[model samples]
Target chain A: MLLVLAVGPSGPSSRSEGVLVRDNNRSHNVRVTDQVQSSKVPVTVLTGFLGSGKTTLLNRILNEEHGMRIAVIENEFGEIGIDDALVIDAQEEIFEMNNGCICCTVRGDLIRILGNLMSRRDRFDRIVIETTGLADPAPVAQTFFVDERVRDELDLDAIVTLVDARHIVWHLDDERPEEVENEAIEQLAFADRIVLNKTDLVSADELEHVVQRIRSINALAEILPATYADVDLVEILDVGAFDLGRVLETDPMFLEDLDHQHDQSVTSVGLEIAGEVDEGRLNRWMSWLLANQGVDIFRMKGILAMEGVSDRVVFQGVHMLLDVETDRPWGAGEERINRLVFIGRNLDREALREQFSSCLVEAV
Target chain B: MSGLHVARIACRAEPLAELGDRIASVAWASDGSALAAGSLSGQVVISDPTDGAVIELAAHELGALTVAWSPDRRLASGGQDGIVRIVDRTGEALAEHKGSGWCESLAWAPGGGGCLGAAVGAQVILWHDGGQLETHDAPSTVASVAWSVDGRRLGAAAYGGILWFERGRAAPVSAFEWKGSLLALSVSPSGKLVAVGTQEGSVRVHRLWTGDDLEMSGYTGRITELAWNSSGDVLSVGDADSVTSWTFRGRGPAGSRPDVLGGHGGRVLSLACAPSGRGAERIITGCADGRLRLYSGTDRSAPLAEIDVGAAVASLAWSPTGDSVAFGDAEGRLWLAEVAP
Candidate 1:
């Protein structure tokens, strides 16, 4: 049973002025604004525990006609047998394969694969990746933010997780739940939309309980119920989850609070960028962080206002794989500011903030 | 001094066939008659250096991560599947060496000897012809490996720094620690100096016997590759976006800061210095922007010639006679260009 839950606005906006106006949902409006006129290809990450239905959903998406060309990066646990099995349809743009999980071992493979996909820029309209069950989504997501080649060609849309409803309670209660729960919960914890599958066996009360539990873990993610892995195609793709405009309009405190409670074993800190950042100073600070606190820092990202560059330089890292790139120019009437977030375990936010702040070049 | 003298030389050549994959490792045959390239698709292709004709050797079950060519031109390649394979002259797998970790880099010892070295995960393995393999503890995850000119020592660059192990020794003779991770290392042809390139874009030169160090700075990206000239006076360093040459002043009393030779557009991935006694020797470089270029020692500000490879040039090597150059690209395409002086 394959399931896909894509959620976003239907059809192109009729607004001729190029800006969609909305009062109640500023977050959604912001996303639409950033996406306007920008043919940013949506990036969807398919994540699940081993055999939790990730590849099943991936196959379904490949077979369907979404009116856009899609590229699928199937990250297998070992050898990449999925690429040979994929029967290509002329309607789809391109289908690529990245065998092995997206971790330290295969990070270089990810960069090369993404670079190759971008070389044929006109062949695909969007990209979809099915991560190995044990793979961490943060590094994969950070790829889009870090590599200049990837950033120039692709825009991350959303991180989608397929939850095994039947095994959820049991998996979470294991003695060393951190092992299974870390990847699973991190998947859901960072999800823009989660597909809670295999729910037909559970009672309505039990399903509600599971939903509540997911909410307790991640308040930002939208939860959708799945029976035998059936989900709407329109509900899971192009969710505009990573739309920067939407990210800015939403209560900044959303990520701040979620960063704190997402994992008792992990924490995230957000820093404000008020001035130009010296590249040398930032390098020293990052070196110190990676050298001293790398074990605790699982992930870090920042939209920096550099000293010379007019656009915001975005940087992200997962463990040792750090990537930095220049993003879209600050639009007319947009404020030039910097914001960085660090996600990890037992990090001293004040110390990090102080170090990062000291890296700022003061106005002479 | 003000403009940082540089020039862009464009090559008029067609692009290599698209392998639809990323290139992982490349090597040039000792005779310079052929080039071998490997990609993430688990395909190895040997090609004619001039016309780019390919002979595919589909041996590995998984992606090949590194390749080395013996002095006699026998090919030894390591793959992500933890297998080291020796390919015959016909590019057929003749022997297999198995290990527990991913084999990342390979280096053939100088001379047509039976020994070959590989940086496999966190350890260095030396494989001899009699089926005996010796292992030495690498300081960190080994990213690159090189053999001393005499084959009596092996140098490996890893996470924290560079480690040199003398043959038959259980521990490293010396270890040099640095701030950032070491990305690549090259031992001088004369066996006098070891050049180490780090992730912070700094190139450090060490006097092999004395452990003295000289660090070069100013690059904003990671140093990707390094090569030492046969005379041991000049060093070629490639980084994420450019390539430069460094010349040492003297052996000891008059030792001075190394002079910089610069020319390259993208991050240089591979470099090779022409053999000694070749007047005004040329340094060949491969870059991310898909170019294979040559620069003369006399005029470091400009490239003598630039050939467009149409894929990221992953590795470069100079022929023994210095009459031709060999390079491999990301798509596992190899090219040999006949140089006219």
Candidate 2:
């Protein structure tokens, strides 16, 4: 295989060592160009279900001697008040835009709170918002883009979703009413980092089952197993999962689809192909796909080899908004390859692959 | 072609005072003698617009969010500290009211009444002469508070709707129900209608007593700036870059087209209409691009004059006499400009 992608339960066993093999070898192949503007403040959104140890992780992030001055925004007043950490209680208010798109909603309270937080920008180096257990993460993520001031001044560093290894499966399988969303699945689908906390409570077999279940829905997120939410802070913070300049650092093996029994559930479809894509054809296909199934697509990210183009095209999207930028030129004699991943509900892998394949350049 | 052209309205602006941080709000006294400005660093300063002499008032601890000058020269300020302080023109603190959440909005009753409405979290407290008269609760945190031209009714805007209350009453006499969050509110001078900028980047107006609602949509960003002309015939709304003023003279702005004003390179942060008799149809807007422009109601294509303040304009207000405009920028600098035909 020209591309090395880890799929199914065969991923590196070193994932439990609290160190990323990719990070150690990052200097070899991955050229991470830090193109994010330095002036913008980075915000990490922490979300999980009940009993997921979200509060424990938040406390660790706050009280740990990380040498970073961080402000915390929470749903209710908690006892996490520590030294110099500005804690603000915000009421989660979801506001739907008047433009009539149902998916184009944002958190109204965050817009107000973040605008006020900007005035005291000199006091803190970063910010973290902890959402309620049952809260949907869409509105929170959308607020950073909907509000002008918040979009201009704040950068969404990453969405760190904590999973209770023993209880997450039950929560993910809970029967939801018609038109009701399973927030647990949504959280996993949208996460940039998955902290599988409380691993000591589940057996090895049970933990493997849970990890497999999670992979059936989301494949791009790097999962770290921990007990009592004791994962290293460096893995979650400053991840740059949403930064246009540096993204798609997932282990390529995760891009291979493992055919699990999925009945209209949230699933991830990853495509790895060897060839350059025609820019015009790729754009047409992407626009058509987004327009047709954007509401069902939670997140999409990829790096493409454009035909006759020296630089690689890095793109990512949340719902209907797609962001694309030109990266550094492909390394000399580097294998020309294109990789794409989609995490969403009711995704048809075959149709998506066919549509994408039609955009590839023909072999001469 | 009717009023002053973009080049004809000449004006000179001078720095009045400088605070420690970003200026949040600025208000001019009714007599145009003194200007009060509040900064996000909790500093409040009262400056003599003529000689630029400034008096430093007490700080608000957290950050001052709003400052309003009453007709009797009493300056009322509120801040993130949840304290509403009423100070006389000499910087004497007459009363201090504390609540549980940030006090972001403050309004004094017009027509010489001393009743001041302060929004401290979900409750709107009507304070009079060192005492709390009544506290009205809303469905959510109050975004703005405005007084009717006659001072008979008070309008408090929250997430669900606008609550209208009479003085000394614990319950709201009436309310205008809406679906989304209201960011800013402005009641027409005729006291017959209320206009609100919503979190959804749209402007909604409700006719008092009739409950007839009008919505103007398609703004580029959240509508945080709304102002009404003296005659109550025009309602100007600010967005990310442009200002659209709707005519409310006829059966309302229902079917009438609005006059769109552009040329500001950045977001419009503050807007104020001139007082009734003197500069009646004129409106001044301060933008994030650090420019202030004067626009006549008759012509919306271009501004009457553009003055660069060199920083994001946080707040601006017109003097009661309508001859002077006071504005504060993000750099904590307060400026007073004299406008002439």
Candidate 3:
């Protein structure tokens, strides 16, 4: 039997008003933002472990008369096929950069396939890439950050990881050969939203265990439990999960609500403070931290309150590639605060909090 | 001083025929009598440059990714549907073969026995006289393939590197190791050197039959537009906006400066070197800014001539005779230009 789950969009707002602040290379800002208009296609990456029901969700997305032409790029040829969707098969080809930058690997196949799809842009409204079970989701996410052509033409909407609630613990604890990674843990750590499927098979207490395990690794992801992948279309499609403008919509209590921990090495660290940060000090700290320990940092996102700046500085990163942008101005009477989250392995929570506090405005 | 100068040589471009869909690949016939263009909407057309005539064929229902001319005068086209077809100039299908996935790369061997090499998915299929000559599975999906000048060896570029194979061999005879993805591959006319445009914004050149390899990095973006001059002494590379030519002489391109041809306002999408034996060597660059610029390979600062093509150029080819050039654009237009001293 196949099972799937769904995630819903937090809220809808005009995503067009955000200003992207590209720090690594200033020139990319001019060209990337120039084409960020409505014509830019949104791509959703769906990843899960084996028996996680990604294909079932894909079939639902294609068969529905949603009035959008969707192109589905599947890593494996599933057992069932749908008639209407423009399905393209992809081989999982991970490409490492020659520059020797750690964690800079990307999915080379997506770069080639996406280039071909962009040529017939009129034939499809959006694209969905369903990664194979046991695939590392980081390379798929990093493709958006590394390739110039893909970065300019397509917007990475979100990474939705489907979880097999009944059998996830077994896979999570499976021992691997020394250098190989546990893909299940990495999937959860990199996810923007996670679908906890097969809820019906587990009791309330068992379901709670699975949810706690997921939250231990990724506290920011919205976990939606379902059966047979019966996810609402609106919640999963075009969520703008990567848009810096949506950073304000996150729940303020998620950072403080993490009360449990898992034995697995991967975990989440959240920092919430009520003060503005010194711009120069924050830049220095962020660059230094990412350069030194970016290999273990799977994903990070934060909405910072900069000193003397009225707008919120929002940033999100996959490994070392970070994209920062200034979001909407703070609403009148809104208390200024900073919220940040880091999901990865071997994170020292106290050290991060201390370093982050040092960058805060010093008791004015 | 801006250190940039503009020079004008006698050159003019005109629309030859429009295919009504985005042209994916363009190639000139071996005799320079016709031009073949494949469109993303699955339309293939053979056009006469001298006259405004066209013969259109529904070659690939899904879309055509590549088109090349066999030395025996047949036009071979491959498409997203994983089918390869060979057709005559009159638009009649002479032969057809099906592969596993999207057939993106096609190259006809130079010795003229009607041999063709194609990269279809992760497998390399060699076709001769309407039959499969040999097939070899690559380590990963094959991105590009090329044939040696003597037609004795074929090089297939994938994730690992270029795998060299001889005819009728089930396994690769040798390989060049590059631990990155190769986007484009080119074998020199002398058949002694191989060059590949990598996914990491660099050009890697390997000396055939030897382990000598060199890398040229620091390009503005991934190096996809690559070309080898007729004599194989020059390799022209294109990235985000500018084109650079590296001369492979003496001990090769090591420790030498490249001549930067900087003028395009957008990414250089295509590059083609003029045929050899001509009096002067020239290379043409088609850019995303909808312009074509021609430059003498030896010059660093200026283009010989340029014209606005009104769309992002997708494919470019210099005719065998070396006096004319044909380029296709994103707007499904095939253009022919006359290049003169």
**iRMSD values, candidates in order:** 21.9, 20.2, 18.6
lDDT of 2 by residue, B215-327 (tens): 87767567889998888878888877788888777564665666777688888989998888866888899898888888876777888778777788779998888877888
DockQ values, each candidate: 0.03, 0.17, 0.23
- Best prediction by TM-score: 3
Give a tens-digit lDDT track for model 3, residues A131-201: 87778888888889778778878989989989888999888888998668999989988888888888889
Q: Where is model 1 chain A poorest over a 10-residue stretch in terms of lDDT?
A: A88-97
Candidate 3, position A16, lDDT:
49
> How well does chain B match by TM-score in each candidate?
0.85, 0.94, 0.94
Clash list (residue pairs), candidate 3: A4-A229
Between candidates 1 and 2, the TM-score winner: 2
Q: How well does chain A score by TM in each candidate?
A: 0.57, 0.86, 0.87
Cα lDDT of model 2 by residue, A5-35, tens digit: 1111111112221111123221111122234
**Arrange candidates by TM-score, highest first: which order?**
3, 2, 1
Which TM-score value belongs to model 2? Answer: 0.82
Model 3: per-residue lDDT, tens digit, B1-341? Answer: 01122233233344677776678899988889888999887888889888868888766866788999887678999988888888888888888888787888999998667788999888998887757557788988888999988887888988878998888878898888778888899988877888898887778888777847778877756777888888888888887778877888895466667778877888888988888766347888888888878887566476767877678888888888888778888888888777763
Residues forming the 10-long window of minimal summed lDDT in candidate 3 chain B: B1-10
